[model samples]
Target: MNPRRKKRLLFATVLIGGVAAVASLLLFALNSNLDLFYTPTEVVQGRNDGGAKPDVGQRIRVGGMVVEGSVERDPTSLKIAFQVADTGPAITVLYDGMLPDLFREGQGIVAQGTLVEPGVLEASEVLAKHDENYMPPEVAEAMGKEHKKMEYSEGQSGY
Candidate 1:
């Protein structure tokens, strides 16, 4: 083989390899930094931890019921605080942004952000009720169970 031809072939091979490497790197970085959605159960069950630190500025979505009487807002600072519950544990959320119109006490919400401190989540966005009579399946199911219990007790008393 001619020396010049050999040199050209080697350069072409290296250039192609370099391009492929760069593309792979970019994809990996993007995937690593992506924020993923998780329901309250998933979050508490460690399903969406992805081996990433839950409180180290990693973007995430946490869905749960908004605890009744836990919603509060500061008119001056526009800061909002609320409690999100999964029927197991509750997480406190702090956000400084306009909340969704459907946000209210005793409703379901999906907060997107990172944990700013232990047991305290700082949300960048807050997603509230999807529609009238619609709630997060988790919250609705929990409420249903509670309703049944109460009804059963009332029936027993009457009997």
Candidate 2:
């Protein structure tokens, strides 16, 4: 190969490698920054386990059943508060935006926001459960024991 051609090829290879490295770094950073939410049972038992609670301003997503009657919307503002449950305790979620169409009482929901305090989620994104049987995998696992208990109870009742 010509010397000049070899140099050009080397430079092109370096440029491509640098671009790839930058892309990988950006992807890693983004993934680390993104956070997900979980139900009360999940929080108690630690489904998204091992990581410390996010800093006050970091984003997160929380999923659970909306407590039976805990939804309260502001009369004039977009602020809304509700409790997310999973057979154990409930986490209070405060959101300040228009809610999804499927958000309703006694239904499943996933709210994305920041954890302003322990057991309190300040949500910026409120995602209602969209499908008939779509429960987050983490939420399902957290509720597994409770579901089994219900099954046992039903068997005993014979209905």
Candidate 3:
């Protein structure tokens, strides 16, 4: 009611508003840049993150085992396509770059890119497991294992 009290209240309100605005901007920036990880089943069945599926044009990361015998490559170009599978189902990933040396059928890998379809991903980067004893934690978890090392015999397919 008093002038001095009124001025103090106004200053407090302004300061709180500025802080809230800055916080909102920071959250938006982080959310926009976030690339959520998903599995083949999650992609097809719809992810349950906050009860919303990933947008068709949203960028994401898919981690799983490279489906055995699912790799197809163009002879004249760097384009390649492969199926990645978890315990539930498989999703196709298309990439246009040199693959890592460790990349192969039954190998665990993570592809980062945009989801152009419900079951297809247009990958911009593909990362393979670095060593025989290591697999990505996300991939392992999706496959029902917790930090399990990858080991496959001949004629075995990645799950």
* TM, every model: 0.70, 0.68, 0.83
Writing each residue's lDDT as its tens digit, candidate 3 over 1-159 gives 999999999999999999999999999999999999998888887765554667799999999989899999999999999999887779999999999999999988999999998889999999999998788988777667543556898999997
User: Which ranges of candidate 3 are over 4 A from the true structure?
Assistant: 47-52, 145-159
Error of 3 at 138 (Å): 0.9
- lDDT (Cα, 0-100) at 32 in candidate 1: 80
| lDDT by residue for model 2 (1-159), tens | 999999999999999999999999999998888786566655545555475545556567777789988999899998999999878778899988889888898887877788787788888788777787777676677577664333455448646
Candidate 2, residue 66: Cα displacement in angstroms equals 0.8
Best by TM-score: 3
Off by over 4 Å in 2: 1-20, 42-51, 148-159
lDDT of 1 by residue, 6-122 (tens): 999999999999999999999999988787765554455454435433545667877778889888889799899998877566778899988888889877788889867645779
Winning model by lDDT? 3
Let me know the TM-score candidate 1 reaches against the reference structure: 0.70
- Sorted on TM-score, best first, the list reads 3, 1, 2
lDDT of each: 0.74, 0.78, 0.90
